[model samples]
Target: MGAWSRLKGAFTRDAQISSPEDLLAQSRERRSGKVPVTNDSALRNSAVWACLRLRADLMSDFPIDVYRKVSGIQVEVPKPPVLISPGGSEVGMKEWMYSTEFDLDRGGNCFGIITERSGVIGPDGRGLPGRIDLVELGSVSVRGKGSTITKYVIGGKEYEPWDVWHEKQYTVAGFPMGLSPVAYAAWTIEETISAQQFARDWFAGGAVPLAELKNNAKTIDREAARVARENFRAAVDSSGLFVHGVDWEYKPIQAVASQSAFLEARQYGATEIARFFGVPGDLIDVAMSGSSITYASIGQRNLQFLIMNLGPAVGRREEAFSRKLVSGPRFVKLNTDAMLRMDPEARARTIGARITNRTLTPDEARALDNLPPLTDEQYGQFDRLFGPRSAPTPPTTAVPGASS
Candidate 1:
């Protein structure tokens, strides 16, 4: 069964997990439909690592800045984990969200433990949470009341589930547990890893000669055997030759395994892993010899990637952060435009189109491109570029010329 289906079935089968205390114990035990994707080494595969890095870096570049609706327009908010850093440090919101989403993308679950700095308030008057800090899933466990998860246990301390931000992909068991792609696609990843290892081992040690010398007449004496061994070792290791006399025959060994097919399988597995992660095959340098997806142009492929793959992934985070980080009309949205942002001329054309269409004002388009609004004189200059907007005055009356 597919991982999602299996997860659903297992959750439904064990629908009786209602007791909060019991859930803590049950969570410690293996839950139904749980599959182990592998430990953290999942990123060791070059293709997986490349895809994940691309996704994470792309999403990260799309800022997760906070905004609130005021009189129908969204305004930036000041309070955030970091105050001024741009590229994002350990405490920066972008870095945190980027890493968290990386985990969700790869392992299917991402978590954060609320800290006092998070500013999240609890229902109780005195006891509550204010903010959250990203926490590793390995350090946290989920416990529930009935089918509903109530709390998460980290180390020995227990905190309400509401206090912990959990972002998951391929969710099952009431959204508390996630089904990892790595787990469901374990066989493919394993095959890729194996192939990689095989290649490494081949190049590392395959330098040795693949043959042995045999005495035709009889088994050589110890001295003769020793000399033969030395000669064979020198020939194979350094010179790639067989310097043997009569009665000593060298037979090059042949591999029973089909190395070519194995290598081809490895290449195939890389693309399959990329597919599982929704990455374009060509993005990872996989030969799309038979792929129908046209990678004809870099721009079009990137545009398609934004619309088809990265857009949804970024949207999920936007929703999650909107729900968890802010309340009411306020929302946290990633600047997805940054992902597919075109060159200056193209961008100007786009914004000009929007302005012409009246979907955006000239000022708003300028703002979107981070340009300040034009001054009155600058506006005149700018409008003049479109040429002679105003009509020329008619010729002065003949009387004025006569007076002169």
Candidate 2:
């Protein structure tokens, strides 16, 4: 059975696996009705591709770091080889993150096989997976029992839960597998695709341009009419100009009303698809009408997107990584400071305010700009130019008597 069919069955408590014959029948039924859509085919839709690309790109750019809680305080630790090279040296962390995140966003589930292990043991008494090779979502199958997945089948081979890595989102109370946003938004995507195809076909030999031409000088026969039509089309196509005598009358055609509506429908479809993927329409260049919310800077826009849309997915991934990839008090965090960085002017102003308020030290602020601490010579130069920094007065008795 295709994963799409299995995904649909997951919503029900009594869902059962269908035999190959039954699956074939279902496939035929779908073929007889509406066209069946697959993940690869769905990408042909511009809006769907844009939404998935935006989500995957943003998630992959953020660095994933490991931290350990020591004495009730969290301290960053070096990431293990599993995180640095999750799919082995062939695939680095950035590419692995992008592939897995792309799958999770599009299919609602990502699966991988544990290929190698490290010497360090985890809580489960086995060494953590040193390398995990991500599997294609279409090639994997899961058997679940009321919110718990029992077995994973990949390439006709069954594996235990510990031997596999699975991450899911858009979860439900009873279903073990996550629900796919692409499946839910299939209708909208298909409609937009159809409209786009129609437009392409219409312009490419589907319909002739509606127009009429007549010669006031004389009446032409069938052969002459064909010659004149071919000559006019050739002239128009070659130079975009058809010169003729005053005896010839030409009237151009106007598009039908229904054809114009398809443009608006496609735009609306893009907005709806962006919403399904939890991406802002503006980020993907989808036009929005009557939008009141505006950002003072790019940082504000990114902050809003992080908080309202991408934050939950990041939290879920953190929990999954912390639970499965490491032992003891170590946890995973996807650093979002890069995504939330402000423009240069706004960043300077904010850092300056923090330094003035004593909430941030000058060196720390400099570190934010990736600069090293100032040396004694540089400090002396600043002192000479801007005068010495202020300091608190020291208490003294003998010094006070001398002054008196």
Candidate 3:
């Protein structure tokens, strides 16, 4: 093989596309210095907001379940210290969920620093993590075995990875380093932001018909030009009048926002950026998507979203939590029932079918509906409806009228 071919092969095989260095090289070589979405200004984009909203919904709506193994059976971890007020005093599950989601989605990593020693013990004599502080993604850096993160360098202090619970997206480097979404799609996001800004500025940045106030008599002074500018703005903006100076003729300087295709380009960019972040472009581009095509139902749409986008991502999170938080049969489960909640009638039918198939129990189905457990009377009624007496009643030997 040629030397050049060998080098090309190496680059293709070893290219860490997720790394900022390679991403920057590509953007700079082709795009005009793409700006990272980490900026405060970049977060204002509608597409960015949509991505954030989706991540937040996934994290917060799907509740966390902590379970422990006792003997040979698995049950809920009795008063799991981590779940009970994870985000320190006063903050609870909701706060923990959002912040963690924010970090994992944007920075590709979420950390929970075990703090606040409660100085108390559980029945098993396991001293609980009193409080959990979420470390800022930008503040921590990894240092350890193949990115196993032996230490988290935060605020000039080093912390053991064990002390700071971490959940990170898988990477080629085998380190816990998560690729930043903003960085990965920087070029697309930057272009979108630029186009939107251009449109805004074109309309609001003193856009007006320029009339060459050619004072052939003498050069116009600064004060005179300033007065003329103010007058021109007031005349054009306030009223559709053309106030001008002496010996000045109108010059057509029409606003060319449409001609520039600023909004169109911005919409395209927004859609592309949304796709880059695994959000459906149509969610942020209603006008572009058009109304002819429609989802059969919201449930189907959500199911598609889960299957095509979030399924693998959720699985990665499950593995991360299971590997880091617990040792044995104890594991974490993200209850996606919230996302699976269908239309009332649809849900009822589906649950009933599942019960018929014996895959889901009546109690389990009721739990999905957020209803309390059935009372004895309700249970008896259910038994009568579909339980032990599912078979036909024994044929009576004695006739109804003439009893034995």
Candidate 4:
């Protein structure tokens, strides 16, 4: 026989002690002086105690499947004939559909049995401090899914089909799976069986009733939580708020920005930009609420305008241009010193001249030194403010009514 089978057989056999407590007391006595109790002892003690507590609750037999059929009856009738008027011909109609549905619910029950064995001899040169053996008999239920179908018919007509969806159920009987009841019984009978071995090593090494073991498991769980938090924080810090698994660089940002820039230009009453971008004025109105600029909305003509009129060309490739705008040498120093230095009226005059394609006055030129700080927010706003004028005018550049 295999070691497990032999251990099981030994446990099933009758023992000298009559009660479970007596068996425990005997096992402790046998090991009292021979082997010092260690952490392993505590675990074993806990398991044995747990088994003792559950011994009375162990199930002797578990339920099994007893398949049975459930019958369903369906009935239908036709309404009496009705006429809209006395002269109208009678009209008849019959019930068109009738059917039933069936399904099964199945479940199983299981139990566990534990036993121990031990032996010791006196100091008479004979065998002493004999081995302790632990054994367990697990009762498990196995079930499988099943199905049934039935159909019925009425005179010269077809009816709906019915089906019974079968589910599996199981219960332990005598032993789990194919094991005999004797083997199941043996798990509760052995003397040297360690409760710890039966409950922990023999099973899943569960850490029940042990604080340290539970804490260790918790520590691992906490570390996992920490790592997840760090990863999420890093992601948010780099890219701002976003939906999970969405590629930030390619998706919603560009889409939203394009939509916003178009809407804002229209809000500023820039019909040319709206039409050039192929977006309606109302859509531009909504997009303007949030500050953003879409490169797609800014055509090549608009980029060219900014490069030629506002800044020096840094670089250019086919269909793409990069420009850099610099303030006067002393403008940065002036901004650092004061905020209310520039008069709005004078600034407006300067902006008007620039808008009207005229040269700046001496006063306006010096006032440019007080230009406001250029932040991303301000830049985005300026794009909406001035972007429309820079947008390409299709009619001006087009040969009227020319076909491609």
Backbone clashes under 3 angstroms, per model? 8, 0, 1, 15
Q: Candidate 1, residues 1-404: lDDT per residue as tens digits?
A: 54445444444553432222222223332344333235366678787888888888887677667889899888998645432232134466557667876887776777776555334432333333344567665566665533566666776677876567677776654545665666656677777776666666665656344567789988778998898788778876796967556787777666446567677887898889998888987887885567666654456678898989888877777787666555456677777767565766777787788876779987887787588987889868867898655654567667655655
Per-residue alpha-carbon lDDT of model 2 for 88-175, expressed as tens digits? Answer: 8799988988998888888778889999999889989999889999988777776666567677778789889899988889876666
- Candidate 4 CA-lDDT value: 0.27
What is the lDDT, from 0 to 100, of the residue 207 in candidate 2? 50
Tens digits of lDDT, candidate 4, 159-254:
222111111112123222222211222222222233323334323424231211122222456776576456655865698653444221221112
| TM-score of model 3 (CA atoms) | 0.70
Who wins the lDDT comparison? 2
Give each model's whole-structure lDDT.
0.66, 0.79, 0.65, 0.27
lDDT over C-alpha atoms for residue 99 of model 3: 75
lDDT score for residue 5 of model 3: 37
Ranking by lDDT: 2, 1, 3, 4
Model 2 ranges with Cα > 4 A deviation? 1-34, 205-256, 290-292, 393-404
lDDT of 3 by residue, 1-404 (tens): 64323323433453322222232333333445444455334578878877877777786778778787788787877545666577757678877878777666765677667775455553334544567788666566555543344566665577775567677663445434555676666677788877666666556754333335455557789999888777777787777787556766556565565646776787778877777678776655533646454788898888888888777887787776565444456788887767877898887788899988779987898886588878888868978888754653566576679845
Tell me which of candidates 1 and 3 scores higher on TM-score: 1
